[model samples]
Target: EIDKKSDIEFTLKVSYLEIYNEEILDLLCPSREKASQINIREDPKEGIKIVGLTEKTVVVALDTVSCLEQGNNCRTVASTAMNS
Candidate 1:
């Protein structure tokens, strides 16, 4: 039934973020220079919201997968005692 509901279209927005060391970074940022510290706040009408985040509208599964891969590549990695 769900699979046959392809005609039911809707907007799908996707965003990626990495939260580490008490900081939130936008993984979808084009460059480090353009990357700004993301913030979370409560809006009276809209409820909790992310202040500044990169969001991309994806039409297909491949598009979403691409976004995920891009963000994953840009993810911050640090050598820890266990990981190193």
Candidate 2:
């Protein structure tokens, strides 16, 4: 939790993606269509940027977990499946 008296408010944003078959795939996108290919380019000030990536804002720690679960569900199925 943030301090009530703090003057600055922080907002955390995260992006989830995977590199498979020599291509970058965004796992957080809601559409079931083909995963968009992302480009990694170095910017003058920002350094590296992944073009066309979806960034989700996490309000809290619990929200981060929810985003992870959503991205996990979007992962491609493999020969192995684990449930716990």
Candidate 3:
């Protein structure tokens, strides 16, 4: 349920990640040639955090979908999947 009557009070931080061949990769990056490893850190003040992950800000559904499409295009699809 959504409260349409209330004012928008929160900002969402969206991050895209995909795991393939036992490696976690950022899908939202502009370059697909290099997939970097993301660091999982335990901070005393902030608790658990994922460092070096690219995040995008989205205000609407279209923006979210656009971000998803960008990530999907950057995904590394297997040759087998492409052949099929």
Candidate 4:
């Protein structure tokens, strides 16, 4: 279950099962996923931009950077299944 109020977010998980002919708490766990920040800066001397990201391993750009001093800098990226 997820409950949201104002700018706060909460998540709760509950699981119940019957054991020994009686109801009991099989599992009760809660988890949360928080957003991370990524910063991207252009390096004029290197002729390429550097991106700092978290939790995400892949980045996709639709447009091309013609002003880039280096060769084509646009390409497709895929994240590993373990990271995903």
Candidate 5:
């Protein structure tokens, strides 16, 4: 389980069954300057595109699965029983 805490007086939670369901990728910063400095690279082959940016917001194209895979033991599977 991933837990996040902030002192900025707001709450945020992001979850995905395939990507970051089991781990936290990176902490969301209060400022874009801080978030920009973070070396969270997705894929060079896919190409990184700067969608938007600001003092409070920064958006970029990234592969969620790549980021999540960096965390420990992120593999998961579902099972079904034939007998009841």
Candidate 6:
């Protein structure tokens, strides 16, 4: 098991993003604003990343599911291709 590996430790973090009409939405942080100008940048060390994205630390299985539920509740579904 991975937990049995004393040489390595793991930390789990979750970020939910929605890409609609080429704009990024921070689903984990649903209250900032519906319209945003969030940018994606490439880092040499961390590779590609989304700026100002919210990350939630998950300790248990339910924690990850809770984060999903929070983000799902805030999802925007309207007259887009998926809804049209």
Ranking by lDDT: 1, 6, 3, 2, 5, 4
Clashes of each: 0, 0, 0, 0, 0, 0
- The pairs that clash in candidate 2 are none
Write down the worst ten-residue block by lDDT for model 5: 49-58
lDDT tens readout by residue for model 5, 1-84: 134654445433233222234432233233335434333345679775233221222133244443344322433344547432
* lDDT at 9, model 6: 67
Off by over 4 Å in 3: 1-8, 32-37, 42-48, 79-84
CA lDDT, every model vs. true structure: 0.87, 0.80, 0.80, 0.27, 0.35, 0.83
State in Å the error of residue 56, model 6: 0.3
Residue pairs clashing, model 1: none
lDDT of 2 by residue, 1-84 (tens): 457768887779988887766778788888645355467899999998998788899988998999899889887665644532
Candidate 4 stretches with Cα past 4 Å from truth are 1-5, 21-84
Candidate 6 Cα errors over 4 Å, as ranges: 33-37, 81-84
Write the residue-wise lDDT of candidate 6 on 1-84 in tens digits: 877888996899998988866678888885766336467899999999887788899999999999999999877787877567
Instruction: Report how far residue 19 has shifted in candidate 4, in Å.
Output: 2.6
The TM-scores, one per candidate, come to 0.77, 0.75, 0.67, 0.18, 0.18, 0.76
TM-score of 4: 0.18
Higher TM-score: candidate 1 or 4? 1
Q: Residue 2 of model 6: what lDDT? A: 72
Mark the regions of model 1 whose C-alpha exceeds 4 Å error after superposition: 1-9, 44-46
Stretches off by above 4 angstroms in model 5 are 1-14, 17-59, 68-75, 82-84
Pairs of colliding residues, candidate 3: none
Tens digits of per-residue lDDT, candidate 3, 1-84, equal 368758658887788888888777888877644447577799999998877888899999999999899889878787786588
The local lDDT score (0 to 100) that residue 78 gets in candidate 4 is 44
